[model samples]
Target: MDSRVANDDVSYSSEAAISRWKFAVSRQYQHLLDKSTPHVLHRWIGCFAVACIYVLRVYTVQGFYIVSYGLGIYILNLLIGFLSPQVDPEIHDGPGLPTRGSDEFRPFVRRLPEFKFWYSITKAFCIAFVMTFFSAFDVPVFWPVLLFYWVVLFTLTMRRQISHMIKYRYVPFSFGKQRYNGKRASAESTSLPVD
Candidate 1:
């Protein structure tokens, strides 16, 4: 009975140690993510690098076309979410984006923020890259057909999204609007023009 108690205590202590270790590792990872949050360019560069690596891996294997197709579809969905507003004007019954120039300026909020979009894309590529190693994902299919189909879908989706933007009179991008660099005209300048 004493030996049994000792063994149980040892296992409990080991489990506690492992839990603590995992918590520490999780906290460290979260800290790194927080630090990287402000560095948008760096985050994007890292994601791009991961994407390139995944592409290279897929190209070298010459398989996993299904995984690639699934990844492409997932990315397209993410892109649409990133481009769209949180509450779509046409679908939801609420105050939508400003349609006229005189309306109040409300900044466009994305359904999926840029950081989440980047993270999801990076993670998806990583998973797809891993899937390429396994033969199960390497289902044989004509690559050109998938490519052509993705292109057609992308074109149609983008066309609809652009039309939605036009209808709502809202631009998703921050720099899409024209900036007023010239100085504002004073009341005196307008009076002189009247004379």
Candidate 2:
């Protein structure tokens, strides 16, 4: 009879442990689901809603002004990139150079870079400021809507720029003759193995 009682207690404890484990696993799964589902859905829904709102608002004159302002800012940034000095201070002086035969690629950062980013951003704000004076953006839309649209547009445009940089092996910065020669020397050393 004592052995029978012990067996029942063992079975009951095992069942209780299994139940607790299952509850914990289920809670963990629910937490993951809650976190991930909203993040992915928010990106898609936010994008779609912004597109719909843009289309709906585009018939107004304010939409045109906003678009023109954004375009102007983008153009200014490109011009700055073109005119800025080619030497990258980060590449030239940041750290010790790699050994003569290393296979690593070091990228250059801009030195004395054109203040284009600041100028373009300031220009956009200036345009937006002027637009506010004309009462054009007050077209019965929430300010948050316009802000979200601009943020999305900026993110998408920046992504495209980054993709372009990745696709093209060229860096826009200028390297002096010495840097160029160093790079050539490195290339030659790597192409021919040490005897």
Residue-level lDDT tens digits of model 2 in 11-93: 99999999999999999986864564446445445445644454455445444545544544565456446533254333446
lDDT of 1 at 90: 81
Index of the highest-lDDT prediction: 1
Candidate with top TM-score is: 1
lDDT of 1 by residue, 1-195 (tens): 999999999999999999999999999999998899999999999999999999899888888888999999999999999999999898988777877788876788999999899889988988988888789888999999999999999999999999988887878898768664334545545566544
User: What are the lDDT figures for the candidates, one per model?
Assistant: 0.90, 0.54
Off by over 4 Å in 2: 1-124, 173-195
The C-alpha stretches of model 1 lying farther than 4 A from their native spots are 178-195
Clashing residue pairs in candidate 2, if any?
86-174
> Following a full C-alpha superposition, what root-mean-square deviation does model 1 have from the true structure?
3.8
As a whole number from 0 to 100, the lDDT of residue 172 in candidate 2 is 55
